[model samples]
Every structure is written in C-alpha cells, then in structure tokens.
Target: MANRTTRIDPAMIDRLADMAYLDRNPAAVRKRVEGMEHLLERLFVIPGINRPVGLDVILDLIPVVGGTVGAALGAWMAWEARNVGMSKFQMTRMMGNVGLDFLLGLIPFVGAVPDFFFRSNTRNLRIIRKHLDKHHPSTVVIEQ
Candidate 1:
C-alpha cells in the first residue's frame, strides 16, 4: 500500500472562511436567501394566475433549447451550493435534484407540467438553507 499526500489550498480556505463570515451576518444571509427565493419564484411560480406555472414551464415549451437553459440554471444553483461550502453529500443531492428535473423536463408536453410542479431550484435552495441552519446556525435569526 502506498501513502498519498494531499495538499490543501490556503487561499481557498480563506475564501471559504470569508463566505462563512458573510453567512454569519443575519442581514447578508437574509438577502442572499431572499434573492434565491425570488429567482425560484420567477422560474417556478406564475404571477397573476392561480395555476402553478412559470417561466420554466413556458420556456420548456420551446423544445430543446428551453429545457437546456432551465437545466443550466438549475446546475448554477447546485454550483452556488458548492461555493457555500456544503458537504459532498449535500452537493450531490442538490445535483441529483437538478439532474432529475432536467431529465424529466425533456419529455415533450407532459414535461412542462412537471417542470412547473417540481420546483427544483426552490428545493435546492431549501436544502442549502437547511444545511446552513444546521452547520452555520449564526446565519439564521429567530425573531421573537
């Protein structure tokens, strides 16, 4: 058996530490979370209509390109999760959510309906927030 040595990047650790500091700030954390919510709303939740439909549904109607764009956006969310220092398990789960959403979205007309209801971005955001809450409690503020 051979022993392998791994090198850690100090700069990367410093960057993550800075992000952790930002996460600890309640206002900053709230702003970030709110921004994510707004994005999900724009993508998944339709306005002025009681039905559950949004840009993701409308865009996916365009066939290949639309679904691809949506999937790319979902992948960006997963990448953001990684930037926030989420565990590999958590990141993998986030990626799975996006992957499933993308695959299901490729199914012709029926795909649009699922895209509207699945809300993968929102789901991933929830997972990110949960991870922050558990591992970085300082980021969450409990109002009395």
Candidate 2:
C-alpha cells in the first residue's frame, strides 16, 4: 500500500477568502484583532444559544498541550486587542493573566485542576471585549 494525504476542497479555499477579515492571522494588526474578536465569540459563546463556553474545557482538560495552547491563543487575542486601541495597562493585565495561567499550569495535577475553574481565557476575553466595547465601539459588538 502507498501512503496518501487528504486534499482540501478548492471551493472551501475560495470561501475562506470571501469570509470576514478577522478569520485568520493577517499581517495587519487590525486584521489580527478582528480575527481574534470573531474567534472569541465563536469559541466562547454559542450563537443564539444565550450561553458562553470559553477556554476552560480546552486548557484544563487536556494534558500538557491543553493549557499551553489555550493560553497562547488567548495571549494572541490580547496582543491584537492592543493594536485595536486597547490601553497599555489593559494589555499588561491581560498578559499577566496569560502568564499566570501558563506558569501555574506547569504543575502536574494541581495546576491543571485550577486552570479549569479559573477560566483565564474567558476572563481575558471579557476584559478585552469590555475595553473594545467602551472605547472602540465601532470595531466590536458591545453589550451591557
């Protein structure tokens, strides 16, 4: 037998181009912010479900990679938020949270346990969301 790899659909590829700006990490900072904003919504809050499902499941549940992946993703979002006009202090605080999650998550069972309940990504998202809502209302959907 010969090894083979799966092929992506061309139509899907085209659709990706037509999609929103913030769907992926573009070169521009604003675009990156836009991407993270969209991801935050889809990843945490289920559309039309009136409930939020944030990064707790991904980071805390899995083994070593879980928390690391989630923390990195959240950090990316926070980084972009700064480009979207978030203040330095706010960005620093978000970075602090990311650092905390990564550092504490290094421990075997105990660290992973707290990461779940803490839900650092969700908290960081909320912080970024609030700042964007208050200042850059035109960029993101701001809710009370």
Segments in model 2 whose C-alpha atoms lie over 4 Å from true places: 1-56, 61-63, 140-144
Estimated TM-score for each candidate? 0.67, 0.56
What is the alpha-carbon lDDT of model 1 when measured against the actual structure? 0.72
The digit string of per-residue lDDT tens for model 2 on 17-133 reads 867444432234444544564453335654795655445444555667866786778788786776566778888888898888877776755776566456566667677667756
lDDT of each: 0.72, 0.64
Model 1, residue pairs in steric clash: none
Q: lDDT winner among the candidates?
A: 1
lDDT of each residue in 1-144, candidate 1, tens digit only: 999999999999999999888754544654565475455446343457765445567767877777888778777767666656778998888888878877888887788878777878778878978877887787776759
Error of 2 at 84 (Å): 0.4
